[model samples]
Target: MPIYQLGQINTAALQTPGLYVQVVPPRTRIINGVPTDVYGQVGVASWGPVNSATLVGSPTDAQNFFGVQQVRKYDLATAIAIGLQLGAANQRIVRVTDGTDVAASVALKDTLGTPVTGATLTAIYTGTVGNTLQATITAGTQQNTFKLTILRPNFTPEVFDGISGSGATFWANLVSAVNNGLSGIRGPSQLAVATIGTSITAPNTTNTYTFAGGTDGAGGVTDSTLVGVDGTSTARKGMYALRGTGVQVLNLVDLTDSTQWPNISTFASGEGVYGFTQGPVGASYSTVSTSLNTAGVDDWHMKVLVGDWVYWNDTVNTQNRLLAPATFLAAQCAAQAPHVSTLNKRLGNITGTQRVAQNQPYSGAEIGAIVGARLDVISNPSPGGSYYAGQTGRNSSSDPTRNGDNYTRMTNFLALTLASAFGYVIGQNQTMDLRREAKSAIESFLLTLQQQKMIGDVNGGPAFSVQLNAENNPDARVAAGYMQADVQVKYLSVIFYFLVNLEGGQTVTVQVSSKPR
Candidate 1:
């Protein structure tokens, strides 16, 4: 085609083995050098698809995929809303239904104690929230006309009117009507994987359909549920559903629950997934801060935000201080890709966004950092308000070599992400070209990070460097089909304290002093 369209063309065809000519533009590969901004969230939504992950890009997507705020059901929805409001531009939510692979569904029943035949109504999801649903059938003005009302949680009653059961499109239209919702209903969905049929005749008598058998297992979510029991089984639901979902971070919002957060965090870390979580909601801010600022079981593969203040709607904004941290951290990470530190920053400000102060309602010792438990909330001099002041989960307990500061974790995550991508690209390359290509890719990635100030600026210096070549991959090892990459990272430090002493009102000028005078 090119030969026929152009007078002359110099192309790769008929070229020597060592050289070629081409006109195609080079394809640039752009990938997140750190954990991608995509957030993988797992929650027990009162209404929405269950046991599967649904992609949600906006607040509306969140509402459509998961139910709106219910006093007992906002475990997932609230965090997602806060994340979006803060900065999560892309996200996915996994609505957990029951322990194991069980689906906690509700079924409509008839007067005879048996499930009604035809026009079956199942909640869009399987959970206790299904109990809130109320479906009713009533008479219409015209003959053979019937009105179907679906009263869903947090949504207006959906009334399907002027139904002619005689038409062939009856079942399809009825399903469509239920799916699209009536005038007032929008978010709280009635049909999760629910279905309705055409076999039932028009209602000559009024009947109300109610569902039963929804359950929240006493054991919380079982271990096998979050991380699939095995590879092939869909029984491993929730976070496991995020496998091919393209999310680099999995934010489990409830750190206090001791059920979902710990299990999900362990799974994420084991799979090289990076994310953030809120401090364990203890009795006070001190305990929460201590849990986050120090390390033990709850601190690996993810960072912890140690504050109990968040902004939701003003009416009961202060009601939930623990739920917003994962979202706040997620938003910040998304906005400043790989810059996961949200310390000393304000989260949200709109009327929909409420400002929650630290949990230091009684003692200000930890708040002012007088006790020096990592970083605590002090008055924000620049912003004229208060904000969190620490961005790390590292403490005296964690390893100093691999993770030492907030920036160090981000750096490691960036390097690892780049390395993962490099491995894939190199797998396609010839064995002989592995070292050269891998080195170049890694070097370019680190260079970009340095230029963007996402990581510390250490040259081939002891602080930061990546080495891959013949030295690390010897001819013997190359022959054995082995590849290795050596990486070292060190982050810069900040001065958090400066002691100033006034000795007996001396007349000496207090100017430019790093020493204790």
Candidate 2:
């Protein structure tokens, strides 16, 4: 028996009697739920490919990809570290710079007659992390040859052995070894690259050289650098680098520019992401509310935290630094399911806040005012308990009906899941069978979500309803190349306010009832 591949074949043409089998695709596509915990951050970093989205799942991964977090503003690694501390499992970080970064470099002198500069070795990536790299030149095991060793902190040393030549030829051989690789010993150097100098002699001395003059270029980094450009796939920069990176929650590290919140909101809406932003550090609650109101930043996809920068233990720099709350909030929210609300949920890894560190927590009036303004706040004593937790789950949306974090997350999750899952149905002919198949796929997926309690039944009706019959998808519309699947989903509401009715005074009557067996 011969098995045939997928295609339209004439079975009648097969004259020979044989058992032929052809595998047909599934009648309906299977719809899998998209992940809701991939956090994306764009900020400055010590070392890494700039304008690229790199996956860093833990602090160790982040340290390896972006170097250690520096004690400075807009540190991408630090934000990632904090997020990891707060249970951010999956993260895609994009490093940005101010265009003035310089790679770490060192000069190696020629060992013949005159010990002039023979070649210059430069770090492959720009940042202060490159300064930790060291290059050593020593005698090789082979006769009339030299060996070069490159060492970096926490990494195995790379050794290029048996480099033989004289003057410029010798330098050229060394540079080629570092840039490319030896035949079988190792791959190309990951730390630095070498450039040969003109009219030089061979390096014949054993000397260890330290790299220097590496700049992170963070001082000149501006808001535009963080927002980035989406010119093209090859030229995307900053947050744009995170496009289509499967990021459910997005944050710009410690960005506090309210002027750009609108732009971020728009991006989040288009990308099906929940964006986290912050107000200015130490700004009063009234000020933040006024600023947001005036800017008209009432976006359902945007969550604006205000007036509560917290002091986090920056173990990387051995200091307690005051940082914005957006990164931490974004990570915590991303760790949760789409239907879960962050309101009253305890946030971890917080030492102190601007309000609490000064012995001034948000008063009841202040909390009410801030929440009323459609902004979120984090405090030590929240309604849930005494541990640090979100005061409210409000997004920047002015509409009260669409303001909760749960609403934004659940909406994005459903919309994006449907959008991704239904693309396979686009080219299929509009028939009752096709419509039924699509409807079945969608209902099965939604039923799973309902069983998981991501959505729930409302008013004795189903949690969701799908309409794909001729009534909704008219013959004229189907003939005009339009196939529609009308869907209505009822998202579970969050309990923001709990009402308790109590009457226990002497004037109140108490009744005893029989208990169930």
**True-structure Cα RMSD, model 2:** 2.7
Candidate 1 local lDDT, 1-517, one digit each (tens): 1223221344435554443333542234444564466777776665566657677778777766665654442367776776776677678787764543223343333233343444566665655556666776666567766566667666667667755564334544555566664345342244543466434433324566666665544136533343433254365566777766656666654544434445556665555566555554333446655555444443336554444434346233445333445555555555544444444455453221122243223244444442234322212221324443232333222444433335534654664686567556544444545556666666676667667765564444444677877788888987776778787655544323447865655676666878965
Global lDDT for candidate 1? 0.53
Q: Candidate 1, residue 111: CA error in Å? A: 17
| Cα shift from native, residue 453, model 1 (Å) | 2.5
**Cα lDDT over the full model 2:** 0.86
User: In model 2, where is the ten-residue run with the lowest total lDDT?
Assistant: 3-12
TM-score of 2: 0.92
Model 2 C-alpha lDDT per residue in residues 1-517, reported as the tens digit of each score: 7777645557768788778898777777678988999999999988888899999997778987789877878888889888888888899999999999889999888765666777788998999999999988888889988889999889889999988887778888888989887778788888888887764566747778889999888899987789988778889998889889889899998888878877788789989999998888888777888888877788899998986898889876899999888877888999999998888888878888998988998888888888888889888898867889888888889888899999999999988888888776677667787888899999999999888988886555789999999898777997899988899888888998889998888888898789953
lDDT of each: 0.53, 0.86
Residue 505 CA displacement from its true place in model 2, Å:
3.6
lDDT, model 2, position 149: 93
